[model samples]
Target: MLFVKTVTSFMAVQCVRSRVCHRKFWGWLNAVFNKVDYDRIKDVGPDRAASEWLLRCGASVRYKGFDKWQKDYNHLPTGPLEKFKIERIDATESCIMFKGFDYLDYLEHVEEIKFQRCIYIQDECLERLCRIQNLQKSLQWLEIISCGNVTDRGIISLHLLKNLRYLFLSDLPGIEEKEKTLQILIRALPNCEIKVDL
Candidate 1:
């Protein structure tokens, strides 16, 4: 109990001082401690909520989790959560589905989104993603890594997000004509900053 409290206190100090723990600190603490105890980290839930609140209040940069349980609760935030980001996302075995993410209309402030190794993405899911125009307008940085099932249409829809500044799609499979897909993405998101690796 002492060890957990000490670490939790340390994390709280960092969060209160800077509003986020550095990546190295967050990673180190996860390695040093058993992160499954939700009670010890209840502050994290509020901290995450505060991050969203700060963004809605016009803070330019805000960061929140890599915590295991938080990933389990990645449903859309209750209100307009804009300009904030999820620095580390792991949706490994959670019931988190692409279909459920369509509730993303609530986030008008999310500028950057990263989905790492969330393998359930499919060609059909892209159409669903396309429906959320609010997300596309606010998104600036997007990364989809190791999503093996995403297809050409998924890449093509990147054009709908006009404000996208940097996009990174790595280790995703399906499109055979790499250059053609790149051209299509460029044409679609004419103002976006793009980099594609098949």
Candidate 2:
């Protein structure tokens, strides 16, 4: 009787493992048992918020606006995150705005940044971007399409990006001296391919 009971129990366990226990089942169990209590995470300010955003997104994240990002993350800062390289970002037509370069201090490994149709990006933002450490070595491609406030001065600062190979600055009405701007950029980045629509 004891031998029969043990055999039945073992068979039942094997049956459950083969039929009921799958990847989704295990994942659900883990979430239910090891859920993170975000309420306990302390706010470490805006700089940490940027790091947290990268941590959550890994290499890619898309949001409608900054408010959505804040709301989705529960407004808590995450930090001392693992050194993960973010190679690309696309924030086209999003309400995301940059306050300063401080927000991107941790993303030193980013290679491409796009803000196409982001009208809020201005000369000050471009100036701040030029100040990012190691940007000249790491950043290769940039696109700021339809950013009307970015003038020749703003685009000029990008000449500091030594590794920059491709630049797209289309639909910028403020760049009245388009020919001069293109010439200056061409002289600065001889190997770069630049596309502009005055």
Candidate 3:
């Protein structure tokens, strides 16, 4: 299959409490650019420019907060995202609702992915995340926080990631089975370091 690749930009604004000035610049970008390669998206109430850079290298993006950027997202160049990185996405709040998990199939070069406050992610997405081993050969770090969806099944699924080095998990809600889950995740990265907060 031919992947139609293009490069696009996405910026977020007014998301964090501390970065008001940064939010202004992105907000301006959102206001001035109409139907540009980049779009202004808001997920988890507001958007952050720090995270939006992930899609700057791609054309089409299956981004969280698609609703906030729906109008802009529709305007993205109709082609494959050339290359992209994903970081610090609220999977439960954004991915599950937006079906952002499907986008992982197109992330051929994503080296790092951090999931935070994503409650919707479950075994199904975790299954897909495990499959990322085939795509992210250069991937080094995977961090997840406050993600109640990643259960033992999801933790066990990570065994295939041979290149993964740093694994960080914190504040996961359904972590009553912490020991078993940690053991499974540790087994996945026999050659790497594993850090977990129980």
* TM-score per candidate: 0.54, 0.61, 0.53
**Per-residue error at 102 for model 1, in Å?**
3.0
Total clashes in model 2, counting residue pairs 3 or more apart in sequence or in different chains? 0
Index of the highest-lDDT prediction = 2
Prediction 2 global C-alpha lDDT:
0.63
Off by over 4 Å in 1: 1-95
Estimate, for each residue in 1-198, the C-alpha lDDT of model 2 and write its tens digit.
999999999999998887766866754543332232233223443334443443333223322223223323344424443322345666566444444235465455667788767655788878778788766677888988888778889888888887889998888877778898889889999888888766
Instruction: Report the lDDT of model 3 for residue 36.
Output: 22
Q: List the residue pairs that clash in candidate 2.
A: none
RMSD of 2: 16.9
lDDT of 1 by residue, 1-198 (tens): 999999999998878877444655754543332123234225444335433332322222234442222322234344333323443333332223453453344445566656556545666656565667776667788777777778777877767777788888777767777788898888877777777677
Off by over 4 Å in 3: 1-93, 96-98
Model 3 C-alpha lDDT per residue in residues 1-198, reported as the tens digit of each score: 133222211122223444886777764553332222222332311122223322331222234323322113325433333322332233323333123443344344445566666545666766777775434575667777788766767766777777888888888766678898778767767886888885
